[model samples]
Target: MKKKFLIVVLTLVLSLTGASSAFAYDGWADSKQTAYQFQFPVLGVSIVLNSATDVDWYSYTNNTGSPHGLSAKLQSPPGLIYDFAMIVGGSTSYFSSDTPGGWVKVTIAGNIAPGETVYFQVRGHTYSQFSTTAPYNFTITT
Candidate 1:
């Protein structure tokens, strides 16, 4: 009886150790890196700027079949002097009325169809009157 009870206790301890080892092997996915490419045939999309500092102004122009626009909302931390303009094909077109604060939205007007690509030129100064680099997340959905 004593030998049988010892064997049973040893088996239970080994099972519990195996279970703890499985839990220790789990890992979380990396959020900062993208796992997949954007899907094609996207109707519209939004670009979120997650910057360590204020974002300098940026520009984006669409030449697809439908007109495209860009909007932004300033988060807490240092703000930016937002100025944006777009030139579709050739003509210069201004989209922003006033300097955007908090959140700003700018729309690009042009014919954007499938396969065509857009071009953008963004320039702005941060609250520190210096250039800042920010990670912009663009999500295009059909």
Candidate 2:
């Protein structure tokens, strides 16, 4: 009876530990980041990358049959290396920030198909500094 009780207690402890470990705060990369639901004319969206390893993700749905016009403007803090990118069908286009507190805009070709997924990611060009204030606005004109 004593041995059975001890084994049961050990099993419970190990199970609890394993369960807790499953939900640990795991950081995300571009490959593993969660996709945020996006629709066009998103405006004045704010984000902060506390470190160079941070990546922000937004996914867009294009339902327009003839292709849609996509644009984004990032308001980046001055003195930081920042860029936003558009990724679709393994193709990429980027807009880089040239000045702090300046707007960086990118125009994507409207060749995207309906029901296709477009991913927008924001990150630092160099991972040495942090961005304290970053806000971006986006639009899709069908």
Candidate 3:
């Protein structure tokens, strides 16, 4: 009976995992879906950048009563590499790492008023410091 119960739990876990992956938002920006949209606890979402100036915009609202902090992890796709960084309000902030295609974690502390629109940008650090461009997946949190 114990072994049977364990098997059932394992199967359930695997099914739920697969379901989450199936529902994960995939693809780039479009007219309706202007940017990669997500709330807290976003799963693996695709972010593609072609060059230094290229970027992916993510939008979220500040609904928490007070200020809330935000962070996102950028992971390289398959075999390629990129230097990931984040900027708020169209200005540059800090980067996750210096290595191309390496994992970059961006952090921000916000005291935004409730119902304010927050824009966070995900960009690649290209061959140039001012312009390192590439692509990867990102998970954001607040």
Candidate 3 yields a Cα-based lDDT of 0.55
Put down candidate 2 lDDT per residue, 66-109, tens digits, no spaces.
66666666666556656778788888878776675566776666
Predicted model with the maximum TM-score:
2
Whole-model lDDT per candidate: 0.33, 0.60, 0.55
lDDT of 1 by residue, 3-55 (tens): 99999999987655321111100121112121122223332222323332422
Model 3 RMSD, rounded to 1 decimal? 6.0
- In candidate 3, residue 89 scores what lDDT? 47
Stretch of 10 with least lDDT, candidate 3: 17-26
Per-candidate clashes come to 17, 1, 7
For model 1, where is the 10-residue window of minimal lDDT?
Answer: 21-30
In angstroms, give how far residue 126 of model 2 lies from its true place: 1.3
Taking the tens digit of each residue's C-alpha lDDT, what string does model 3 give over 14-116? 6554212322222444222476556544534654555545556666677777777777677775445555434444455555565545677766777555766
What ranking of all candidate models by TM-score puts the best one first?
2, 3, 1
What's the lDDT for candidate 2? 0.60
- Give the residue spans of candidate 3 off by over 4 A: 1-27, 30-33, 40-44, 47-54, 83-87, 94-96, 127-135
